[model samples]
Target: MSSGNPTVFRTLNERVALTLLLEHGGLTRAELEQHTGLSKASAAEVLRRLENSGLARKAGLKPGNAGPAAQMWQLDGSAALVAGVDLTTTSIEVSVADLTGRVLGVHTTDATGDVRRLLGETLDAAGFGLDELDQVVVGVPGVVEADGRRVRQAVQLSGWSGLDDLPENVRLENDVNLVAIRELQEHEDSSFVLFWVGGGVGAGVVLDGGLWRGVTGRGGEVGSVIVPDPVTNGRRYGQDGGPLGALLGAEPLAALAEAHGL
Candidate 1:
């Protein structure tokens, strides 16, 4: 049920319709209503708003069973563009995509001094200016605060903690969390755990079709778990070389594999 506020209801309906079009391609008014469970009048109003905003358009006409042809609507992918940046310890990868998630360009370069400068270079390589981007999603190799302001525990990637002059629309997310998001989207029915054993060790958990972000947004800091110390013969708390970290971390695991002649 829609709230009494017409503006809120209209905006919600527009979003629902836009999401459906983006996911399912072109759809007729009746089809939109059927899929969205919206009334005929509400669907028409939502479509009108979407077309007015230039976010959607009538793509073609669909032949109805008995009545006249019905107009088909689809999202205008070119209306907006977004960028995704994967910032790792050794390299930075950037991809420019449209509203419909079509990758327009991809660029990769070595990790450099200035984060903002690298972003600018990536945007230029993608044939777009910063002004043209609607949003920029940055995947960093550490825990990002829920507010998306700060990054911590990413010692390998310096100059990211105090990133200045970043664009207002930029978003910082943990690399593991981004991977978990991709996993969730690819497998909607299954919940699973994702382990990232790169320069650092981390875990991402998805439960009941949603990412389980615990308190303080550090739900997957499995590397920090304390366990028995090999040398001390006692328990020790360590993040980089803790028990879980020693077992699953890239460097330690690689060394172990070499020692085992595998």
Candidate 2:
């Protein structure tokens, strides 16, 4: 039943187990076995790996019951820091978090045309240089390809074509996708869509606990969802600022209501 990547898979499972321990507090190995559905041996193996990686440690013995109390595992809370950057058309925010997802440092800056300089500078300001980064998740407001190289379009930023330079390890994901991922991480069973009605109208779909990255990675582009334009009586509006302006000003709603004789 091994997938040929037992080490890698078990390491990931150990991380999941550690997350469960953090959320529910310490649990016995039997409890972990039930929660993770791993065999007792696999669970023990992962626990050993977690302890070795310094991400988790064995806490003191749990009180009561039987001859010897089981040693509980707890999150180290400061292992392998991760940085998340939310880059928008006008603003940028950088946050540093430990392995436990605890925010350690945060900084914000106004975004210029180029974000590399801003990212480097803000990362330095946060005292978290690129070398210390275990992972950098960037939430961008645009359609990013699978390679994260070319951006189809960013609704908030006009004339923004694509990124000039992106690091190898940095993950560039759509803002709404990031939102969905964050939501799913917090509430795994919740099924919902994130509608971002800011500079433009767009949505990120979370169906059956995963993002639907379609053929072109443009599956959730709600702005491209063409419906009959009420003002023009079933005419299609191209992706532009006109519809957004009307939506913001309530003109579109009013026009639709008037057209409907309401």
TM-score top scorer = 1
Against the true structure, whose lDDT is highest? 1
Decoy 2 TM-score against native: 0.78
**lDDT string, candidate 2, 1-262, tens digits:** 7557867787689768978987877777777899989999988888888889897888788865767777788888777888898887777789999876789899888756666667878888888787778888788877888776656767675633336476765778888888777788876766678877665567778777878778878877776554545466434454332344445335677776887899
Computed on alpha carbons, the lDDT of every model, listed in order, comes to: 0.81, 0.75
Flag clash pairs in model 1: none
> What's model 1's lDDT at 96?
93
- Runs in model 1 deviating more than 4 A are 1-3, 65-67, 159-164, 186-191, 227-241, 254-262
User: For candidate 1, lDDT tens digit of each residue in 1-262?
Assistant: 7459988777888888888898788899999999989989989988998898999999999998898999999989999999999898777789999998889999887766678887888789878887789999888877777867667567668744345347788888888888999888778867899988876778888988888878878888777676554432343344333566666666656656776687
